[model samples]
Target: MTLPRIAIDAMGGDEGVRTIVAGVALARRRHEGLRFILFGDEAQIQDALGHHPNLSRAAEIVHTDRVVAATDKPSQAIRQSRGSSMGLAIQAVKNGDAMAAVSAGNTGALMAMAKLALRTLPGIDRPALAAFLPTLGDNDVVMLDLGANTECDARNLVQFAIMGAAYARVVLDLETPRVRLLNIGTEELKGTDEIRDAAAFLRTASGLPLRFDGFIEGDRIGSGDADVIVSEGFAGNIALKTAEGTARFVTDVLRRAFTSSLRSKAGFLLSKPALHLLKVHLDPNNHNGAVFLGLNGMVVKSHGGADEKGIANAVHVAARLVEADLAARIAGDMARVGPILSEEMIAK
Candidate 1:
């Protein structure tokens, strides 16, 4: 199968060119016909490519020493994006130079640049940041608006639901993804007016390729009860951080307990296999890519501190989304429900 080339911000990650190059090389080894356009310092990228002959043969370099600093705000970053690796990588997507773009850079800056360059799909008011979260169910759950818009109206939440469900369908390979709104309670009447109104809209809207399971409390986020969980950015961001923190806390506690004494050490040795599986499930690297949904083009964000394995996962994510034609899928879904959204907006 012929895959679309991916544009990467080689100088974006915390580890800079070396880690990004190594990760791209790893992804190339794992997936055949994966081409890359590395945006960074030409000499540095060339030096890194020397170590990976396979990648060297399949990759091209677009030199640029300019970078978006971690500390740079979105406002400032947008002004200087044209010459930065992060900006150019996203630009490649808008310019049709690449099918998708991947960056391990400033989240705010990346979002700003991508929005400015790619714009949102016709029916979407704004793009939401969506990512896969490990779940106890057979498939990972998709959550969105992790930090894109702090406050959202009922219309925004409804759009997020559609976008999130479309993403879940592509990534999880489900025909009808079950979706829920993040709320304080699962009761019929709960959350703010926006949540209730959004639920009402989903309940009445027809022909959507999703199953609306109503409001899902924060505590049940990982219960796998729903395939897609939609929320405003403020709450969504807090929920994401809390889940990550809780995972780390659990791992730390287990490590301490396992080394407390000889008895515990013996128990740990006996449970090594189970523990290994648990570790793999909890590792952030396994779920590293956060995609910007509702955008006219595809752009994925890799955690700044992600290692080669994590970065590779991000690249693979971009590849899968491109292969699935995520943008078109979303556009189609939005078009299907455009009339419903318009009526809802008019009613408000």
Candidate 2:
């Protein structure tokens, strides 16, 4: 199958042109059909392209020395976006120059530009930052609203559930993903008014392609009980950071325990293979894409510190979503239950 072209913000990440070029080169090697349009400094992009003849042939560069700084606020960056690599790349999506855009730049800036350029899909109040989280189940869980909007009402939470479930179906290949709201407790009376209202709305809705599994506590996030977890930006961001911190803590503790004594060192050697597997599973690079769902066009956010492997994974995610027509899937699901959701929200 022919894949859609992706526009790359070549000067956005920590290593800028070098990292983006190297990652695109690696991705093209694995998927020869992948195409890219690079936006950055002409000389630097050309210099990096010299190392990968295949990518040089597949990519087209649009030179611009301008870049969005790591410290630039979203509001400030959006005004200067016309000349920056991040801005131009997102514009390519809006202009149909590329089907999707990818960047490892300032997360706030990228989100701001994409939302402004691409706008939100019909029935979507705001876009949510969604990503896959490693779980103990057969597949990873999809979590949403990770720092996009600090505060959200019942309507936003319900919309997040619809968008998150659509994302899970495309990425995880689940037909009817089980979804739950992140809350203080699992009981019916657990969370705040917004959470309960959203849950109540979802339960009464008849036509969405998701299974409403009620509330899921923060501790149960990694248990794989729900395919999609929804929360307001404030709580979602905290839950995401806590999970990441816990992963690092476990790995650090294991490392220290394995080196405490000669006997422990020997034990570590005996369990080398198992430990290696665990390390790979916990590596953030292996799961590097965070998508801005509810957008009219596709935009993927790669980790700013990601290496070639991480960048490649992010590109792969963009490709998968484009191939699955995620926007249309989301729109269709919303249409199916739009009336029911509106009526329920009004009744409350």
Candidate 3:
């Protein structure tokens, strides 16, 4: 089988081309048949690749000097970044030259460029940012609309559930992902009208692979009550940030406690092996990629400050999405969903 090419915006990350090139090399080890189309400054990219000759066998560079700044607003990036490396990489997906595009660029800028260049898929009004978060359960939970759209209506929430489930199928390898609406309470008559409406649709909607498990409260999110958590961006963003902050806080407190005294130091040595396992599970590098779902083409966003390992994980995510045919799965399910539910929503 032939390898699919991935387009990468090599200039956008905080660490620059060296990290991007090295990341690709690392990803190559995981995915044997993957190829690359790298976009960035020619001289700098070449310099970065010099340290990783193994990358050259599967990579090709498309040099462009117009780099999108981390500070650029989405509007500004859409207008001025059309000729930049980020723009070219996105364009590669639009032109079908690459299976997907991966970037560690400005989140706002990448979203703007991707939306403008690739547009949303059919039956999708807005593209959502979806990622898998490590959960207490045996599997990760899929959450969506993370900082993508600040507010979404009933239809939008329902759409998010569908797309989020599609994502879980790929990333989590779930045969049938359970979908839940984020609510203040799990009771039948709680939360906003939008949440209720989405729940109603999911419960009644037919011909889709959705496993509607009713409403799940915020507290239950980490408990793995649902495989896919659907919320508008405002709440989703807050949940994501809060989880991250809490994780860091616990880590800091643990470090301070472990070194507080000689007794604690001895205990720390005894617990070092278990702590190492915990640390590996908590590291963001293991889950570095967040996908933009419902886009016309595939795009994976890496954390801006991600190192080579993180970038490689992000690249691998793009490759996996391509292999799973994420876009086609979403598009197919969407076709079944629209006709079944749109009329009911219109009647309401």
Among all windows of ten consecutive residues in candidate 3, which has the lowest summed lDDT?
Answer: 336-345
Tens-place lDDT per residue, model 2, 119-233, is 9987888999999999999999999999989999999999999999999988899999999999998899988999998998899888888999999999989899999999999
| Model 1 per-residue lDDT at 246 | 96
Of candidate 1, the 10-residue stretch with the lowest lDDT total is 339-348
TM-score of 1: 0.97
Off by over 4 Å in 2: 1-3
lDDT of 3 by residue, 224-342 (tens): 78899999999998998788778778989999999999999999999999999888777777878899999989999998888999999999999999888899989987887877667
What's each prediction's TM-score? 0.97, 0.97, 0.97
Candidate 3 scores a C-alpha RMSD against the true structure in Å of 1.3
Query: lDDT tens digits, residues 158-256, model 1?
Result: 999999999988889999999999999989798899999899889888777899989998888899899999999999999998999999999899999
Ranking by lDDT: 1, 2, 3
CA-lDDT, candidates in order? 0.92, 0.90, 0.89
